[model samples]
Target: MTDSSAAPLRGGAVGIVTATLAVAAHGMAGGGWADGSALALLIVVSIGIGAMTALPERSTVLLLPALMAGQLLAHIALSLGAAEMHNHSLLPSTAMIAFHAAASVIAGLMIAAAERLYGPITSIVRAVLALLTPLPDGSAVGRVSMSVAVPSVDGTALDWVISRRGPPVSVY
Candidate 1:
């Protein structure tokens, strides 16, 4: 995709992916499902992060930190919105932290790899499609058909021709 056209898509994809991974990681770490308000907050924060990430040129290095930061922010939002909480502290337990970190790294790597491969994959798909498209019939290749207007003549002149194996033949 061209840089200009790709920005919005990349931004949206990054935001959504980060937010989703954050929620999933929280659940996997036994954080339970986030409430509606928390989910809303996560979405907003993720969008902001995504917009920021999209401004720069495409790079896996830049995206990694943005994803990680977005995940962390989302986790905080989730923690704050919970009605009943297990951990009273500001930070989660070491195990939970580790889980989120691992999830972020894995997800970030996969997303980055996909971004890298997207250009090549699209080109290949286009090439295949071009090859698959039907061509004009062979019989129509040499066929000639046309009309012309003669202003000098009182009636409109008709000029047409047909092509066969021998030579050009005027039909009118």
Candidate 2:
């Protein structure tokens, strides 16, 4: 992806993660879920994502949920704006709040699940390869293949095995 795209993409990731933390924390504070349970689930989901990201080439799996959730947010913003202008009703806005939150969390968990469903490492490799589209006489996909390459070595290998895939990756 272009730098412009990558930058926003990274931001989307950070936003989702931070958003997840905030909501989970809010849920905990609200006493909606057991103090530890909500946090625990969040941690597990985070760890699951990270673990799945680590597999040799499954890093792309990590982006799936982020992208999905990001798109959801973008769409929500657009529709919310229209709704706010037209209906003057808080319904869509309120639904966006609830649905967006749930969707993001679900997206995160689904990303983790995708990693598990398909070996992270292996899936990542496939994702990368998918970017290297072979030349054709002329085609859109062939014209734009830009998947980031997955590397063999990643930070603190063993810790990564157990660590949650959050930002600020440890340098090893």
Candidate 3:
């Protein structure tokens, strides 16, 4: 069975890269890359959450930690650079790093919850579309006509264990 979650995972990765580039561009233009790095980390975390919603639940476990690590690394680099350039103390930088890491982890958990619900949400949408579609006989559809793929082993595996096509219902 072809994994349906692949598309969302790829999309999320792309989104992260795009957001990072956008942050870099803004930092360069404003000459505040170091100061803006905190904001950039937050933005990246938010974007990652949005993308993770479309991914499979199991993937979130790995992805979230990876994202957090990336954010941590970025935060450290930015903090050190800013401290060196401005000859500032490390106390404030340490505090900011802690905040960013905590925030990123919280965002990851939210994304995981969203990802867990994605399949059911998509199923409901498909069901609604089936009901809304008009029939030649002027009857409303009762069920999804397409083959529904059920994810196996919790939300981690997208292996289609059952493929069932509902009764044929004509739609105009």
Candidate 4:
């Protein structure tokens, strides 16, 4: 059977793809090579973030900084391009970059949280099923132990669901 642990990684991948495509579409309508190229680079950085989060074991502490760095790099590229073309001022560029960075970081965190939460939520559901229905041994109907481990802000909690039959079926 496929391991359930990979679901979060898959979700992160989907988030990255969505972010990249959104930026690509924006770049396409941006009406200049500089803007388009800058957005393209941002997409590359988003891919990196996706890759980092795609690992089976990822450190949540590093997520913020990684995302910030990616945003800063993309912003710098865009700012420089705009300056060379004289299409935008440094002040406005900086403001826009900050806004975009904040938005991106917030979106990334939300995506991560959703992905992380999926396991426990689904496990809780399954545990409920186990409790409500009889198993082959008829032991799970009334003797089920259901627990949901919610993650903390830093992602330093054991997020799992445990349903006991003859043995424990834990999804973490």
Candidate 5:
């Protein structure tokens, strides 16, 4: 079994939190706090996914694809509805649905582009490392140098993205 002791939950937790914040911010843009409630479930699922990866028997190799797929669908949905969103609007329901459909396609493509740019190798490595490291709690240097991302990590850390495996057991 991999060293479960070393697989801290903070990184995945942070990812969930940040993702939730972003989602909430998007929802709040539409003038509602109700969407943020979904974030609690997101945090739980994120941590559970990470912890499952760290377990002794099963590997989390399969988890990433499903997680990625679900998130892709969600963001696609968000981007779709958000495109047609306005603080105040009285457009016809048909127009709104049509707009949302177009937007969903675009957002889905955006996620697809992100997946292609990052590639499976990069994505899997990051997922594994996120499961095994103090991802959310780190020094500035560590944050800048030793992190993972898809499209980006922090807003400014895009160029510093990682594309390698997790740290060796001895390094931990």
Candidate 6:
């Protein structure tokens, strides 16, 4: 894909991943889910975070901060945005904050590494596939074709095989 298309794709990927991880981490750490208006607001916040970090170049410096900020904002949004059923407190405990921080760092590192290596890895895979793919004409490069001497024209399967030499020969 072109660089222009790639920018939006990468941005969307980062945004979606950040939002998913934040929400998952919040729930996994025993933080109650905030539905209704809170959920809507969190989506907006995540999109904003993604837009802010949407650069064509791979940058851990930018992505890490964006991810960290997204996580923090998500936490606050969920904590304070819950309805009566959730009843979550606005202030999080030390452990909860620590969990979010740790998750943010680990996830950020992984995402950054993947983004940094994506281009090179994709090129390598494409090169390998190209090398392994067969030619359109079904002929091998630098191969010499040999003529076979037929004593007689016999209507047999062997005659079919003998007509075409090398890899393209078929007995069917």
lDDT of 4 by residue, 103-142 (tens): 6577567756766676778889999999998578755567
- Write model 3 residue lDDT over 1-172, tens digit each, in one string: 2235654754475346434633353244332455555556546554664465445453554655665555555544444555445443433355444554555566556555655666788889989988998556645578547887776557557546456778899897
Q: Quote the positional error of residue 144 for candidate 5 in Å.
A: 50
Candidate No. with top lDDT: 1
Candidate closer to the true structure by TM-score (higher is better), 1 or 5: 1
Cα lDDT computed for each candidate against the true fold: 0.74, 0.45, 0.52, 0.56, 0.43, 0.72
| Model 6 lDDT at residue 147 | 100
Number of the candidate with higher TM-score, 2 or 4:
4
Best of the two (2, 4) by lDDT: 4
Pairs clashing within candidate 4: none
Which pairs clash in the backbone of model 1? Answer: none
Model 2 bad stretches (over 4 Å): 1-73, 80-85, 88-92, 120-172
- Judging by TM-score, tell me the better candidate of 1 and 3: 1
Q: What TM-score, computed on C-alpha atoms, does each candidate reach?
A: 0.69, 0.26, 0.45, 0.46, 0.27, 0.64
The C-alpha stretches of model 5 lying farther than 4 A from their native spots are 8-35, 69-172
Error of 6 at 123 (Å): 0.9
Give the per-residue lDDT digits (tens) of candidate 1, residues 1-172.
3334455666777798878887888888888888778888888888888898777465556777888788888888888777476364547767668877887788777766666676778889989988999677778767888997555463333323333368678899
Worst 10 residues of 1 by lDDT: 155-164
Clashing residue pairs in candidate 5, if any? Answer: none
Instruction: Kindly provide the TM-score of model 6 when superposed on the true structure, using C-alpha atoms.
Output: 0.64
Tens digit of lDDT per residue, candidate 2, span 66-159?
4344434343333343432333332234444465566656666654453344445566888888789744556446476589765457644455
